[model samples]
Target: MNNPAPASPSPASEYGARARAWDWRRALAPTGNVGDAVFRAALFGCALLLLLIVVAMFVEIGSNARLSISRFGLPFLAGREWNPVRGEFGALPFVYGTVVSSLLALALAVPVSLGIAVFLVEQAPRALARLLAFLVELLAAIPSVVYGLWGIFVLAPFLREHVEPPLQKALGWLPFFQGTVTGIGLLTGGVILAIMVTPIVTAVVRDVLAAVPVSQREAALALGATKWETTRVVLANGAPGIAGAIILGLGRAVGETMAVTMVIGNRPEISASLFQPSYTIASVIANEFTEATGDLYLSALVELGLVLFLVTFVVNGAARLLVWSVTRGTSGVARA
Candidate 1:
């Protein structure tokens, strides 16, 4: 029967073929349009938020400038004088203090936080892990003002009495530790910042480590790896995430105001010694913004705010790129 005429190319098969070949352009056009609309909406929202922050910062500063921002121009950033009454404003010392203190905070906080996160996630029992996580989160939720107050009264005094003096005595040869123990200084501020950022890094790194697959750990163990070895490999694999978390903590430290202002001593001078008092961008803004008067003075302050915002944005963007690269590289290596 000629194989039943090839089953007459069954209608169901034809229908299926037709469905697959249907006007995809027409069918997907609406969906594509909807997706585009959503993307545009998100983009617009982000732009709006950025615009709002920028405008607010400018407005706040413009309202306080002693002279027009254009009048002082580039000198505003390089000029050392900051006399508002004289309509003079310079950001050099503040910038110096800001960057140095934040870097110090990162140096102190990152490793400690990583260690804490690794221990909590890999070594601690579930009960202990949960407890630790809760505590860290609680620390994070504490207001910045409270931390500042505590830093000034409790931490600064302790550092002045114990930590700063000992370090200065031991590392007196180093410029950073050359000065005599001052309770409120760059070192003290850095220490407080480290403490403030520790919980952030720990929480982030813990989550990152926990996200690692159980099977990967099992495979490492099956291959006769020690616990530390497995953790090292797994953590190394998650290095990008850990770095991003540290960067995030750094950003937080850099932008912190109240706590830092309280402990930083808010000195408007740059010094080689961490033991000497210093100021930061946030502290400068917090301490001076309210008191700033005159167009040029106010503009200079606004310009400082702009610099801080840009610096933060750049750092965060770089961190995201680093994380992205790490994730992409790891996935490719994993597949290979």
Candidate 2:
């Protein structure tokens, strides 16, 4: 049917115009789906890599601690004895020191950190606030070894000469405040730990408090609230995130090695007095990792490392979960 070549359907020019229109439309549209997918996959990969690294750490520690785990059984935790030569190992003393020192550090750090945070967020002039924040965070930049050195040469002497005596004279009746006023003890270690962790606590709290919506402060003040009241209300609102920050600091205190070991006297004893020498899991590992000749001794230290790792992991994990929950629940606030 050569009926005028079937009118050639449509003209080539019309087909070209249709193609050009399609091209223009596509240019105007969002068309980077493959790029978006690649970016999303990369982010997911980073998250998964962190999780896998954590799992790998647990596996490595567990595998190394197998000998001690098999040898000690449940009594390992309760037993207080530790002798490398005798191959008698118990984690009670280390556990006690770690917990007590961390608790003490927290007790000392929290109030001070909160005060600094509040001062910066609600009270200080902007310039002054920035200056103070810089100084506060500078503490975190100091090395652990330097803190240990300062603890040994400076803080220890100050406590021994001045601070410990007053506490001993006033509160020596209590078990916790008894014993010889040695500068290098649980209390001293705790103080060192407190100094080390204060930056973390303050920095976290400052950010958390700052993340609180301006409207929250305005709302509190609108209801005839005083400045202090407004601040308190804001704090209460951010309490969960604050708690997470404190827990994160506690984790830091728990895992401190050289600074604590240098000042804690490295005695594996569960004494009631803060003045008494004590040993934490980390301190023991730092002090004895090289001297651990026997397989059991090495394994015991590795097990202590495992314990410290688990404790840190659990604390940080809980803090992250709590912070996430608080951030998710809040409105118009940055993620903690």
Candidate 3:
């Protein structure tokens, strides 16, 4: 032992050993920096401010709608007649129109959006994908009023003359297709909404699909999967994100005002035919808010706003949950 003096550990070797034993948990442990604490507090305050703003909006709308809420109670939602002259108001038609139009838009937009997203993410050349993606996003940048104007001038006439007549001849027996083929009606509104929401949905879905790990695609392909099969695997993995995109598009359709108001014919009547004129909650609010002379009329309109607000809130919340669920599930799977 006296004959042997152990050589001092080299600096490089010591550092290498320390690095090998390093724990991420210990590395990330709080150092109690004042700057970090301040930054965290600022972020929390910003988040809280958003919540406060949402709460404030709800409270304000509810207070304004109190008159109609108290007078009509639950029946306001169910009442079919909307007569302001006689002081009779019902939200059923607006609710129906909003639901039907939004759903119709989803039905029309989702397939097309998904196809575009898939092509952009997986099939198209890089240059072509970028061009198409830019064009698609450009659609979203156009003003809503501009869409309304185009709908009124172009889409409405085309549908009324060319599309509706053929559909009526082919599907006349169906209640949805049976009606006067007016360009400015529920169907037109739905088409306009589809166009408006398409860009949003496509962009989101493209991002989501792109976010799928390349290894996942490679793994599927290496396992004898065809290109389409590989694509399907990617789609399955990105399902939650795709769902969130669609829901977000639905929210956009639900809250759209100017364009819907312009094309939806603004009639507060419920007919089985999509060709018939209709009014949505947002459209009705936009149309009548300025014209509401009576307190009850104003309150009824405010209540409609509240209804739209609640619907949008629920849709977005569901989308968030769907996204979160998939994220958590993926993380858990990775850990296992």
CA RMSD of all predictions:
8.8, 9.9, 9.6
State the C-alpha lDDT per candidate. Answer: 0.77, 0.86, 0.88
Clash count of each predicted structure: 8, 0, 0
TM-score of every model versus the real structure: 0.77, 0.85, 0.84
Q: Which structure is stronger by lDDT: 1 or 3?
A: 3
Off by over 4 Å in 3: 1-46, 324-336
Candidate 2 residue-wise lDDT, 1-336, digit = tens: 235423323545655665554453223323324554566667778999999998999999899999999999779889988877787898999999999999999999999999999999999999999999889989999999999999999999999999999998998889899888889899999999999999998877887788778999999999999999999999998898899889989999999999999999999889999999999989889989998998889988999898888889899889877565556544433222
In candidate 1, stretches whose alpha carbon ends up further than 4 angstroms from where it belongs are 1-69, 72-75, 321-336
Best by lDDT: 3
Better of 1 and 2 by lDDT: 2
lDDT of 3 by residue, 1-336 (tens): 156535533556555655676644334323334565567667778999999999999999999999999999989999999999999999999999999999999999999999999999999999999999889989999999999999999999999999999999999999999977888899999999999999988977787787788999999999999999999999999899889889989999999999999999999999989999999999999998999998999999999999999999999788766655454433322110
